[model samples]
Target: MTLGIDVVRAAPKVLLHDHLDGGLRPQTIAELAAGIGHELPVADPAGLGGWFAEAADSGSLERYLETFEHTVAVMQSAEALTRVARECVEDLAADGVVYAEIRYAPEQHVSAGLTLDEVVAAVQQGFDEASASGGIVVRQLLTAMRHQARSREIAELAVAWRDRGVAGFDIAGAEAGNPPTRHLDAFEYLQRENAHFTIHAGEAFGLPSIWQALQWCGADRLGHGVRIVDDITVHPDGTAELGRLAAYVRDKRIPLEMCPASNVQTGAADSIAEHPIGLLTRLGFRVTVNTDNRLMSNTSMSKEMHALCEAFDYGLADLRWFTINAMKSAFLPFDQRLALINDVIKPGYDKF
Candidate 1:
């Protein structure tokens, strides 16, 4: 059966890759920017929202990333950070996201004199307040800009806050010049401390980026590893072959945090119909759907699932599989993951 958008929105979902900075409400950005005297490209909330979505659809990774200047500018204060973070949880919960790992770079929020630790504390405060009401469980993933030199510091910060709402660490930015291996020291430190991290690779770049992220940095998961499809070839007779890297990824069950809308916006894939997700899912890769940037992509978990259903003719079972895959790949404890799957995700899907 074809799932309607309403049904998809009502289904419980899990998101592994969402950017906190990229998901701010346009109205909130206008308000915060006004408070801080920061001038936006568009003053009207609706216009600003449209501006972000349009500007991000530029088909260039670097150009797409340029939309963040306004969102990041307004988020420099503790009050703004807390408000955005709190609203993020509330919004996700309302959209049927039962679990999520929201990531943002702490260093980016420290420009207004807040320290990295203070920034994390502020964001966590917001998450804790919203999570206290209880429909959703949310955690933070501290990200370090791949073009910067503070990854080791961010990794340590994630470790320090591991017990308090922070789940993992990540590195993200334009992937052309900034390879994941550049932060080897940070990844090594995370490994020694038994911390988890996912690297942004294979989105703008290709197979070598994925190979280096897995083999060199020892990433726990791959962020937008869409280009891994480069290693697989389909024959005219309908047979397919996998290169060593593709075979290893599937064999190891490495989770690919696939963000369809964001991928299309960044020119990672031509369109949803042509996305690599269909082939990867058919071939048994650990594919999990996500909204890499909600404001930028103008998407939510429900919208992403609905799009996949439309494109691949997926039903509730397929949606359930994606949800289960995401939960299994989460940075949460194994026992906790099992409980959510059995008590929350499975039972939730069974009702449909």
Candidate 2:
């Protein structure tokens, strides 16, 4: 039997889809904006929160992304990046996230005159400081912008910081016009270096993007792979049929970093009540729940799990599976990942 919502909220969670730039504290944004003299859509924290939610609910990824202008505007300095990263750890720890990998494109933060190496160092320092004080273990995923031609540089950057704090690499931003294959050189380089990377695919785009990411670009995982559902077919007898790509993904246990609230906001799904998370979970797709953006989507790991339970009637067993799935998909080493599952995740699930 499943415990109540409180028990669920207290369950140890693993997050893989959180963005470093997207989960900024509203107060931090206001303070950073003030320091940089950048104008904001809203000043008060309460109003700023509402502004982000409302702006992101526009149902168009392009329009929804316009909101990041204000966020990225203030994250130009080392001090600002460090503060945001530290706060991200503190907030995730409070939400019962035991392990999280936060992703951000370093090139975006360089417009304010900081070097790419400086941007990575500042965020890494903040993560180290926050983890020293907090109970959560936070890792960084250095991201390359898909629209730009800097994936190889970002991949090298992630490798350069592998010993510091960066756990892996990723390609983010508008996945429509730009495909992961555009950065094949970067993925090839990372492959040669024996590095890990996840590609943002099948969110706003369809399966071709996903196919290329996995087959051509060789992504270790898929971000917002909600569209993989397109490859599945339901028969009159209610048995599910998986297309070749879907079956390969399932057979290989490639992780799908599904962010339900963010998916709904970006029109990846119609609504929370009608998301494919339940279907994907039932089909054993190695689905893991996450908060893509805390400020923009106004979400956390606890809130995201609670919403999943409400949407799919999930219980402790289902929640535990999600936790294990995330731990399996994390870029951490195998022994450490198993230790976390045995010592932390399973014990919490048993308590519930």
Candidate 3:
């Protein structure tokens, strides 16, 4: 049975990859920008929202990333960070996201005289406040910009705050020249400390990026590993073959955090229907759906699931599988993950 959008929206979801800075409410951006005297391409909230979607749809990873200038500009202070983070939780909860890991680079928010620790504290404050009354549980994943040299510093920060609320660490940026191995020291630190991290690979780049992220950097999960499809070849008689690397990924159950809408906007895929997720899911790979950037992609977890149902003819069982896959792949403790799967996710989906 084809689930309607409303039904999909009501299904409990788990988001493994979402950008805190990229999911700001349009109205909040307008108010905050005006308060700080930051100039935006469009002053009105509606126009600004449309502008971001259009600007980020440039079909180039670098150009797509450039849309963050305005959002990041308005988020320099503690008040702004707290407010944005709180609203992010509220919004995700309303969208039926029972669990999520929101990521952002602390280095980018420190230009306002705040230290890296202070930046994390402010964002955590927001998450805590919203989670107090909660239907949702939210955690932070501190990200280090791949082009920067502060990854080791950020890794330490994540470990320092792991008990406070920070769940893990990550590195994300242009995937062309800045390979994941550049941050080998940071990943090594995380591994030694028994921390978890996901590397942004196989998105704009190809198999080499994925190979380095897993083989050299030792990432726990792959961020946007859509390009793993390149390693798989299909025959006309409907058989498929997986190359060595692809076979390894599937064999080990490495989760691919696939963002369909964002991938299409960034030219990683032509359209949602043509996305590699369909092929990957069919091949029995551990695939989880996500909204990499809500404002930039104009998407939510519900919208992403609904789109997939339309594209792949998925039903509630399929949606349940994706949510379970995400919860299993989360950086949360094994016991906690099991509880959410048995107590929350599976039961919630059974209601449908």
- The weakest ten consecutive residues by lDDT in model 2 span 1-10
lDDT of each: 0.94, 0.90, 0.95
**Candidate 3: tens digits of C-alpha lDDT, residues 106-128:** 99998889999999999999999
- The Cα error of candidate 3 at residue 246, in Å, is 0.4
Candidate 1, which segments miss by more than 4 Å at Cα?
A: 60-63
Better of 2 and 3 by lDDT: 3
| Superposed Cα deviation of residue 199, candidate 3 (Å) | 0.3
Report RMSD for candidate 1: 0.9
lDDT of 1 by residue, 1-352 (tens): 6799999998899999999999999999999999989999899999999989988986665657678988999999899999999999999999999999999999999889999999999999999999898878899999999999999999999999999999999999878888889999999999999999999999989998999999999999999999999999999987889999999999999999999998888778889989999999999999999999999999999999999999999999999999999999999999999999999999999998
Stretches of model 2 off by over 4 angstroms after superposition: 1-3
State every prediction's TM-score relative to the real structure: 0.98, 0.97, 0.99
Candidates in order: C-alpha RMSD to true structure: 0.9, 1.3, 0.9
Which lDDT value does model 1 have at 184? 99
